[model samples]
Target: MPKLTLDDLAKIREKTKRLTTIRVGGEYRAKVCVHMGTCGIAAGARTIMNALMKELEEREIHDVLLTNSGCAGLCSREPMATVEVAGQAPVKYVDLTEKKIKEIFEKHVLGGKIVQEYALGIGSEKTDY
Candidate 1:
């Protein structure tokens, strides 16, 4: 592979700083993971990611960040996602469609509330992390 130029290095540094800021001073402002395995894409992970980005923008919460990861060992719930707040426990939300993404954003991200019905409990055996 070609060596990275100075400009490329600078851009990478800028992005690193931005990502650090989004972590919100040791507290995670928000963490959204969109499962991106083959099954997940088939189940609309793309739409979920789009909705999440739109909601984060609309809420004007610059600290939140979005990411994609491989399957979370739950292919039956292919498009599964997890949200983790600074102090609160992480919650897994399954069966995500675009509409549900908005609801999750509103209740969980903006309001600092967990949609319990949709949330797989923090201590559930399925939780690997």
Candidate 2:
């Protein structure tokens, strides 16, 4: 195995930092969270995630954070995702497929309009605090 040179290490560190920033909700314009729990995977969450990734790459879209979380307590709506654009409330989209996810990305993430047809709800649960 070839040892990494100093330059290679620096590059790796930079890449890692960039990704960490995105995951930690850095100055991103939008955020997509795909539910990847067991039920979600069974219902094709992986495919949904891949489709979103492909869209981001094809459009060369930066400033959008992609992430995953566990089941959203709606097992029936297995393949679910949440799209949150900065300054707007988060929208939970349910029963998603690759096609639906792609459309959601274009309309909601990029176009800044909620795709109401596929959206389960808007905004997170209210906290007592």
Top TM-score: which candidate number? 2
Looking at model 2, residue 91 earns an lDDT score of 95
Which one is best on lDDT?
A: 2
* Cα RMSDs, all models: 7.5, 5.2
For model 2, the superposed segments whose C-alpha errors exceed 4 Å read 1-25, 125-129
Q: Write the per-residue lDDT of candidate 1 for residues 1-120, one digit (tens) a residue.
A: 659988999999977776577555644577777888888988889989988988876765667768788777778886888887767777888988888878888889767898887776
lDDT of 2: 0.87
lDDT of 2 by residue, 15-67 (tens): 77765675676688898999898999999999999999899878776689898
Reference-based lDDT, residue 129, model 2: 50
